[model samples]
Target: MLFDGDNDQKNKFIDHSMWNRLINDAKTPLTKGVHQFQVDLEEFLNIEKPNSKRGDLKPINVIKKHVSGEIAMDKLEELKAIVHGITSV
Candidate 1:
């Protein structure tokens, strides 16, 4: 099954697509001033801090959260939460 697939090139596109949507959404605001998005982003990164600390995972480990399936639901939610970190929401 494709689910079992592990093509690095294909996975890079998937990761970019996912993160770009979020990064674009959480990138800027209508007003020119400090924003909560930064703080929320920090919190979001902290969620994955454990995996980061290990230094064993790939640089694009967020993509793995997808391969992990629903087992990584909370991580997805954290991603959503981070995307909403922008004032646009």
Candidate 2:
């Protein structure tokens, strides 16, 4: 099964028992804080509910639409800062 397949179709790619253990670990307090940063970042970028069918509407595409235009200068700087902050962490 391919990675793009539905969950059931991709089950063959994983060790279910080990996957279950990882899922359980994800619910623990230590892992909870780690995942929260991802949620916050997605919300900050307005891509928290990304739709595969509308890739062009995402931030990267939006930024690309006006990268060379004056209107995008401030936004581009803001985006650069956010990206750098994430990478630095």
Q: Top lDDT: which candidate number?
A: 2
What is the alpha-carbon lDDT of model 1 when measured against the actual structure?
0.41
Candidate 1 lowest-lDDT run of ten: 1-10
Q: How far is each candidate from the true structure, as Cα RMSD in Å? A: 12.9, 10.1
Q: lDDT per residue, candidate 1, 1-89, as tens digits? A: 00111212236336644444444456344533222333233244443523545744533464554555523467568656544663335
TM-score of candidate 2 versus the correct structure, residues matched by position: 0.30
Candidate 1 accuracy as TM-score: 0.29
**C-alpha lDDT of all candidate models, in order:** 0.41, 0.42
**Model 2, C-alpha of 47: deviation from truth (Å):** 14
Estimate the TM-score of every prediction.
Answer: 0.29, 0.30
lDDT string, candidate 2, 1-89, tens digits: 00111122225656645544455456544332222122223343443334768845555654545554523456557656655554443
